[model samples]
Target: MSQDERPALEDLLGAKHRWYHVVDLAPGVTTPGWIDLRPHVGGPQLPASLQGQRALDVGTFDGFWAFELERRGAEVIGIDVDQIPPPDTPQSRWAEVQAELDGAVPGTGFELLRRWFGSSAERRSVNVYELTPEAVGGPVDLVFIGAMLLHLRDPVRALEQARAVLRPGGRLVLFEPIDRKLSKRSEPLARLMIGSTIWTWWYANRACLTDWVKAAGFTDVEDLGTRDVVDSTGNKQRHLTLHARA
Candidate 1:
C-alpha cells in the first residue's frame, strides 16, 4: 500500500490500539517505543515529548526521534531526505532506526510526514540552509536538530528559521560531537581520515558554537561537552549535548 493508505506507524505500535506488539533490534540499533524512549534519547523525557504537543525534527534521517516522541503521545511530524544509498551507506542508518523502534514499541501513535527543510520541501532530503520554519507550519513547541548544525554553511540563519517557527517558550535540543581542544591525536585524524584537515562537522569548538547559538536568538545556551566519549576506533573524543530555549 502507498504511504497515504497505510495506517500511521505510531498507531500500529501503540498499546492502546489493537495489534500491539513490540519489535526487537540488535546492537547499534536503538529505535525506542512509547514504553520509554527518554532515558536513552535525551530530550524524549522532557515535557515536550508528549501527545497533542507538536515537534519539528530537522534532518531526521529515519524518524527515530520522531517515533519516540509520538509514542509518548506527542503529535510528532518528521521530515527527511528519503533517498539513502545502500542499507549500509550513511542513509541506511534510519532504516535501522525505524526497525529498532518497531521492535521496541510496536503500536505507537505518531505521524510521519516525508519532507525536507527548504521552503518547498517535498518527500525527500532538504537543504537546511534553505529550509524555513514558516513552510513547515510554524510555532512548534520543540525543534530537534541532531548531528546537523555543524554541517550548515550558515548555522546562524538556520537557527533563525527555527526561532521563526518556535513559540515564545519553545526549546531547541542540539546533539553533536565536538573536537578536542588539547588533543594531539584529533588533528591528524581530521587531516587524513576525515579529509580537508581540521574542523569538520564531526567536531566543533565551544567558541564557535556559542557564537552561532547565541546569534540565533537562543537564550541560556549551555555547551555540555565537558567530557569524552568512546568512538568506533576505541578512542575518546569530545562530544556535546546542548539545550537552549527560544
Candidate 2:
C-alpha cells in the first residue's frame, strides 16, 4: 500500500472511538473494533450471494456490513442517525458517548472508511424510524440491521418501517441482543428493558422477535439462532439473528 493510506490509518488508530465492527479495510489493515462479524456473514444470517439485488443497511456504524453487501454485487445504501455535529435528542447522547470514546464525532468514521475503500455504496444521515419506501427512494431486495434494534425505543415500529422499505418477497435480516432471562424461562414474547443506564430500551426474547416480524406483515420468518459477541469491554452478549420476508 502507498504512504497516503498510512495517514488515514493513523487517524483511525489515533482516535479513541469505540467500534462495533472489525473490518479489514486492506490486506494488512483492520479497524480497531470489538466485534468481528466477518466470518458469520453469508452462512445463515446473510445471503451467500446478493448479486443483482438492492440492499439497505440500518445502523451501519462504520460501513462494514454495507460494504460487505456491496462486495457481493448488491447496490447498497446505509442509513443511520449519528449526525456529524451531533443532535440534542436522546439518541445524540449515545452518539456523544461514542464520540468521547472515539475522540471524533459519531458517523464521521463511516465517511472516512468509505473513502478509504473507494466504495460506491451510498450512505445517508437518516433515523431508523424515518425509513420508508419513499424516504429510501424505492423498495430494496434486502434490509439488514446488525446489533441495532435494542437501542431503539420503538423496535416494533422500526421493524414495520423496515418492512415497508422492502419489495414484495424481499428479505429483512436482523441481528439483535435477546433478553436472556426470558429466553431461559422459555416465555413467549418476553422483553426486558435495561433502560438508559446501559442506553438500551428493550431486550426482546427470541419469541418476541419472531412474533414482531410476523406482526409486521412478513410472510415467512426464520430464527437463525444465537451468536455470541464480545463488546469493547470484554462483555459477552447473546444476539439472535432473524430472517423475515416482506
Candidate 3:
C-alpha cells in the first residue's frame, strides 16, 4: 500500500486530532512498557477530558500511542531525544509494530524521529525542558507515557514534569512496564526488529503505582485497567493504562 493510502493512528480511533509520537532509545530487545497492550479500542475508562484537547506524547516509540491519542481528539506534539535507530541499527518502530504477527512489533508503524537517547547530554533542545500550564498554551489534557517511563532512571521526576505540563484537571495516561527478570539473555530477533531490547522499568505493583501517583501530588488517581499487547507467539507483556490528575 502507498503511504498516502495508509491510515494515521488517529483515524483508526475515529477522531481528527493532531498526533505526535516520541522514542528516545536504541533498538529494543523486548517491547518497552515491558508489558502487553490490548487492542486499540476506546472505553469509558478514557480520560473524560481527552475529547477535543491537546496531548503530549512523551517517550513515544514510533508515535503509536501518540497517533492513538490523536484519534481520540487531542492535538498532539510529539517529542523525543532521538528519532532514528542507534548508530547500531537501521530499523524503526513504525515498521516493527507489524512484526507482531511474527511475535515482534514491526518497525514501520513506530518510526518517527531521528536522534539517540543519550545524545541529550552533549546536545540538548530548548523544547526538552520547556513547558507552559495546559490551560495556557494548550496544556496537555492528557500525556501518554508508553514504554518511556521504564527507561527513565528517575521516573518520579519525569512524572512530576508531566504533571507540570498538564492543567490542574489534566490526566497522565501511563502504560508503565514494571521490571522483569527475563529468562532469555535476550530475544535477539525481537530486539533487532522492534528495538525493545535495551528496555527496563521498576516492575511496580498496581498498589505501588497508585501510591506513586499520589506521591507525585495528583489529587485523584484511578486505574484504567491493564492492557496486554500480545504477539504472534502468545507471549505478552503486561501493562496498565493509568489515569491520574494534576
Write down the TM-score of every candidate: 0.58, 0.84, 0.56
* Residues 54-145 of candidate 1: C-alpha lDDT, one tens digit per residue: 77777655455655555566556555543322122234244654553454422122222221111111222454554566656556788777
lDDT of all predictions, in order shown?
0.51, 0.76, 0.50
Off-target runs (Cα >4 Å) in candidate 1 are 4-40, 43-45, 81-125, 182-202, 224-237
Model 1, TM vs. native: 0.58
TM-score of 2: 0.84
Worst 10 residues of 1 by lDDT: 114-123
Better of 1 and 3 by lDDT: 1
Instruction: TM-score winner between 1 and 2, please give it.
Output: 2
How many residue pairs clash (N, CA or C atoms closer than 3 angstroms) in each of the candidate models, in the order given?
A: 21, 3, 50
Model 1, 44: alpha-carbon shift in Å?
7.7
User: In model 2, where do residues sit more than 4 Å from their true spots?
Assistant: 1-8, 15-17, 42-44, 83-103, 189-191, 194-198
Query: Residue 174 error for model 2, in Å?
Result: 1.1
Give every collision pair in model 2. 16-101, 16-102, 17-102
